[model samples]
Each structure stands twice: as C-alpha cells, then as structure tokens.
Target chain A: MIWGSILGITFVVALIILYEWPKLKQGSKKEKATVVVLTGAGWLLAVLLVFFPEMPGPTDVIKAIFQPLGRYMEK
Target chain B: MIEKGRISAFQMAIMMYLVVVGTGIIFIPGITAKYAKQDMWLSPILASLAGILAVCTAFQLHKLYPKQTLIEYSVNVIGKIPGKVLGLIFLFFYIRMNAGGIRIYADFVAGSFFTETPLIVIISTMILVCAFAVHGGIEVVGRTSQFFIPLYVLFLLIIIILLLPDLDFKNLFPVMGNGLMPSIKGAITPQSWFAEFLLTAFLLPFLKDVNKGRKWGLISVFAIMFTFVVTNLVILFLMGSITASFTYPLLTASRYISIADFLQHLESIVMAIWVAGTFVKFSVVYYAIVLSTAQLLGLSNYRPLVFPLGFLTMLFSIWGVANETESSSYNSTIFPFFSLVVQTLIPLLLLLVAFLRKKSGRRKPN
Candidate 1:
C-alpha cells in the first residue's frame, strides 16, 4: 500500500512537471497559476494516497504488466 | 568547425567502450552459454575480431576525411541525394538501437529489482536522464563516461574477485566438446554489438587528434572484449551448464555471493553499475541520433527535438517487443545482419565511393 502511494505520487508529480515545462519555457503568466494549482493538486493526491491507505482503489496496472516476467525469472 | 565539442581520442575510446559493454555484461554470458556452453569465452574473442575489423573500416574513413562527420562526408563522397538517404537510414537505425537499449535496461530492472514498477516508468525515467545528458552534448557525455568507466571497471573486478571462491575450474573443461560451430554462432550475436564501434564516425570529427582515433578505437574494442571474456568465464565457472538457462546469469551469480552469509544479495550493486553504464550508452546513442538528425535536416537547434524524440524512443522501447522472449529472439536472430548492414556495409560503401570520386577527379578526360 505504501509502495502504491509512492507510485501514484511519483506518477502524478512527473506528469505535472512534464506538462508545465513547456509553459514555463514559453513564459506565460496565466499558465503559471495553473501550473502551481496542478502541482499542488498532484501533491495533495500523493498525500491522500499515502495516508488514506484503506481507500478503495483499482488494481495496480503496472504490477500486472510485470508479474509475468517476474514469475518466469523466479522459475 | 562543423562540431563545437572537442574530446580527446582517449575519451572517445572510453565512451565507446562504456556504450558497447553496458547491458551486455549482465546478459551476454547467458546468451552465449546457451549456444557455446563451456566455450562461451571463445565467442567474445571471435566477436572482438569482428569489432576490430569494423573499427578499422571506420578509422580508415575518418582518416580519409578528418574534419567531416559520416553524414557530411557521405555527401562529399556520394551525391547529395544518396548521402542524405543513407544518413536517414542511419538515423532510423540509431533511434531503434537506442530504444532497444532502453527496453533491455527497463526489462532487466523490472524483472529483478522493481517487481511492481511499470516498465514504461522505468524506461521513461531512464530516457529522461539520457535526454538531459545528451542536451549537454558530446563533451558532457565523454567526461561522464571517463568518470564512471573506472568505477564500473573496479566494481566488475570486485565482483569477479568475490566470486572466485565459488568458481569450479572443471566447469570449463572438455573444451570445444560440441566443436567450434556453436562458439562461432554465438560470436555472431555479440559481433553485432561490437560493430557498434561504427559510431566513431559520428564522433571522429569531434576528436582533438585524428591520428589517435584508430588507436583509441582498437583500445575500446579490446576493453569490451576483455570485459565479455571475463564475464563469460566467470558465469561458466560459477553456474556451469545451468548458466544458459538463467536470463541474467551475471546478476544471478552476484546474487549467489555468500561470504560468511553476510555479503549476500549484492544484485543491487550490480544494478547500480549497470545503470551507470546504461547512462553512458544511452547518452552516446541519443547524442548520435540528435546530431545526425540535425545534420540531415539542416536544423540549427537540436535541443528542441530532444524531448519529443526521447518520448518517441520511450514509446518504441515499450512497443518493441511483446515480451522478453521476443526481445531475446530478435537479438539472436535478426540483430547481427541488421547491425552489419548499418555499421559496416554503409560506411564501407561510402568510403569506397569517396575514394573513387577522388580518383575520377584526378584522371579526368582531357
């Protein structure tokens, strides 16, 4: 569960930064507030995922992709 | 004057060695063992000869035209249209090769350490790191390789030393029991990897001293050969016949390290070293792709393309194979000939055309 939150947080933060990079380079003041809000939202989501461990969630899609490879190697 | 970066021939050699020897250290032993069995060490020696030939061909081309990259010289050698077409082909090859390397690294990490990590995440993170390094250009890549190569070599030597106790000398016995054909066939897979030294064409123009280029190229090939030979022998000594069955024999061997039961599970250390090597390799290939693309398309700024191209590369790495088995199958079957056409045949053809054009100019009909 802790790992899931870390993944969720990292994914969100990375996406937000990637989105804001081009806008920051473009020097748009209107986009600056949007970037800050998105970043904050990303952080908030991360924290919620971390602390609220019992929150109902969908299955981890990433783990499903890798599980087969792991099983084969283990064998 | 075409390129601003200035790396010494020695730095170029180190960079090339780092790129060539990266993921192969962990995976080649198993791949070769599958074909050559106990004779796996011989495969790299044979592959090294092919590497030498490829490097020598590239060096001769560089010597013929010291100031121009392969992209530029191809135009001077062949007609502009033909040269541009060839350059495009090379650009595509490097792009695919870079993506393939990223895939291999991501797959290995996902298969071993980060069981739950998304392969896309692992691959994208690596591509992000490489894109940043490549944006800094060739000098940054060379210097980084110089700094990390020694440490990588040291770690490799330390691993070999630790595993020495577990090595069974008899496992290497009954040499050539299946005869030389298997080892020869095994050599084909790695020979493609060795031929990657052809990248020196892109790097040669940036080298500080053209004369040392060939010497450094040979040195890089020898260094790669030494690494492969040592790794194959170690896996054979430690895992014996079962080495072929394991996907990553070197990592497994490192995992088996048990000194007083305390020095176990050093696969993370191996992972760290492998990541460093991957960084250098990815940077080199990424830089080559960007520079060659810029040269081909007449783009003044290569920086803007870095992120978009990296995203595409990450996507390709994810989609390149359905699974690890397909990836390995591609490596063993199609990769050698693909590498030969790109690395050896194209460059050799360009060199010959350049020479013939010069000869025809000198002997014009009066």
Candidate 2:
C-alpha cells in the first residue's frame, strides 16, 4: 500500500513538473526563482507527507499558537 | 498585472456567496445548535450584521484604492515597512486559512462517506482541482461559481423540502427561553464566516464595474444569511434539539429525506454539490493567496504559485490532527476566535487606519 501511494505521488509530481517546467523557463529570473523554490519546497513537503503521513503538519503548529489562548478563555 | 481577467459585479456576487457558504453550511447547523439550541436559525441573522460590516469595510478600502487590492494599497495607507509586513501577514493568513478549509472539507467527506479512503487522497484530489481553477484566474472562478450557484441551491432546497414531514416546527418553541446571550454567543462563530466577505477586497479590484460593488456585496451577504436561516430551520424542524448531537445536522437531515420510501438517501448528491461549493471556496481562497503573494513579491504572474501552493495546502490539511477528535475540537473551540481576529479584527484595524490617513491628508492642505 505504501509503495502504491508513493507511485501515485511520483506520477502526480511528474505531471505537475511537466505542466510547470515550460512556464518556469519562460518566466523572468525572479519569477523563475520564486516558482522553482516554492514548487520545490512544496513538492518536498508533499512527498515527505506521502511517505510519512504521521509527520506533524500545520495543525500542531497552530494548536501550539492558539491552544493556550483557548484554555485561557475557558478559565 | 498577473491577473488580467475581469468579471461582472453579478459574478462577483455569486463568487462571494459560494465562498461564504462553502464549508460553513455543513457543520454550522450542528455547532450553532450546541450553543443556541432551537434558536440556532437566529444566530445567522445576528451574524449577518457583522458580515455586512466586514463587506462594507472592505468595500470602503476598495473605494479608496480602486485599482489596488488590500495587499497593494495597504502600503499607501501605512508606511512602507508596516504595509509590506501587514501584506505578508495577510498572505500567510489566507494561505493558512485555505489549508484549514481544505482540512475541514477532507474531514467531512472522510467522516461521512469515504471511510476507507486515506485523507491525503481526498485532500490532494480536491487541491489539484482547486489549483487548476486558481491557475485559470479569478474570472474563471467567478464564471464557474455563477453557473453552479443556482443548481446547488435547487438541490439543497429540494432536500429541505423533502424532509418537511419529519420536521417538527414545535422544535422552535420556547424561542430564546434561555435568553439572548446564548444566541449572541452562537453568533460569534458565524460572524467569522460572515467576515470572510473581506475576501471581496481581492475581487473588488478586478470588478468590471467597481461602482456596483457595495450593492452586490450586501446582496451576497443577505443571500448567504438567508441560506443559513433556511438550512437551520430545516434542521430544527427535522431534528430539534437533537440537532446538537449530530456532527453534521445538515447531512443528517438530508439522510432523513424519504419521499414515498423510493426517493431516499440522496446524500451522495448533497456531497457532490458540497464538493463543488468547496471547489469554489478553495479556488477563491487559493486565488487570493496566490495573487497577494505574487503582488507582495512583485512577481509577474500568480499561476506559478498555484501548484506549489496546492502541495503545501494538502500538507497543511493533513498535518496537526492526531485524529478526528483534534480536528473537531479545533473547529468548534479555537476556530471562531482565530477567525474573528484574523478575518474581522485585522480588517477593522486597517479600515480605521485608512480613515485616519484620509483625515490627516485633508489636514495637510492647511
């Protein structure tokens, strides 16, 4: 099942790369850098998440930020 | 300059309606019932006032800037550093909120129907569709919403009607018997929803006729408020206080639709249109984030950001929740306060600051 999902992930990444590569090439240096960096970072996070679904994401980060306040409100 | 497509004011109205109604209608009925009991329907009406305030304030900002979104014109109101900082905060807020919205959508679908499917699958699929729409720009999102809104309403209203026999109008009795404070408290959550109209700042700049913004803005708020009232009433009549027990009162009520026993269990259809509504919602939020980030970075286009953002969105949606318990608690408890501050209070502050700047500018004539 894990391998299957990884294969699915690879296919998706490939498709996105194909779709974006030309546009990324045509864009200006700033645009190219922004797109590549963002797309690369996003892709890396998504792939890691696909392999390790248990990895903590945004919810914990947010809960750490807001949960204290939420408890304070209840008091 | 990334987005050149312009949509008519009416289309903007539809997009606003879809954005507000997107994931809200699914869970709000149950959540409001927990606080307001039978008066859950009234909460939305009360919430509408704040929604109006949010839309109007965003409109006021738009009127001042005319051609710039909240991101661009914000710099002119405040000094450069603060304006850019606020703009960055707004971009982050929209992106994170969009992630949370997708998480809510994934949770609902997974909780209700797709028990066997992995959540990442659901989150990623929806994000891809939304990223595609966001890539097409705001015009596509607006036009698509305009086409889907009526059909969504028709089906939703049909389900509400089909459940009439089961509805207990007696459920609404003893209205505010617990007094108005609870209902007012209930209003807090929906107010966050209503304040989401601040998203209009993004659409306002691209409006074909900026003059009609205020009129349609109010209309969108009214229409959404009215839908909430109707859906809550349907849930009340069908389940009464029992509405509080169900996680999704609207979905639960929809399951009760049995016309002569042959027409029943049409929740699949409800789920489909809901997915459609969420698609619109995701696109609007995602487009707002992409456009804001592009403008903030001085990029030439927003399209490059869409695919990357989609991945990030899916990652955020899946992260943090240990299980369903964490998701639901976050949704009910902290979410309202979080939304109200970000969606309502921040925009209110910006509006106040803009007003002060206007006054100070006139004084400079002396």
DockQ of each: 0.04, 0.53
Q: TM-scores of all models? A: 0.83, 0.94
Tens digits of lDDT, candidate 1, B36-72: 8889999999988878888888888877777777777
Tens-digit lDDT track of model 2 for B1-366: 668999988898898898889988876777788888889989999999978998898899887777889999888888889989989878767777787778888889998999999887898889888888888888889888988998899998888778877777788899999899878877867887888898999889888899999899999999999999999998888887778898888887788778887998899989999999989998998999889888988898888878877777666766666577677677766776777777788888888898998988989999
Per candidate, native contacts kept equal: 0.00, 0.58
Top candidate (DockQ): 2
lDDT of 2 by residue, A37-64 (tens): 8767776776687677788765566667
A33 in model 1: Cα distance from truth in Å? 29
Candidate 1 i-RMS: 11.9
Stretches of candidate 1 off by over 4 Å are: A1-75
How big is the positional error of residue B164 in model 2, measured in Å on the Cα after superposition? 1.8
Highest lDDT scorer: 2
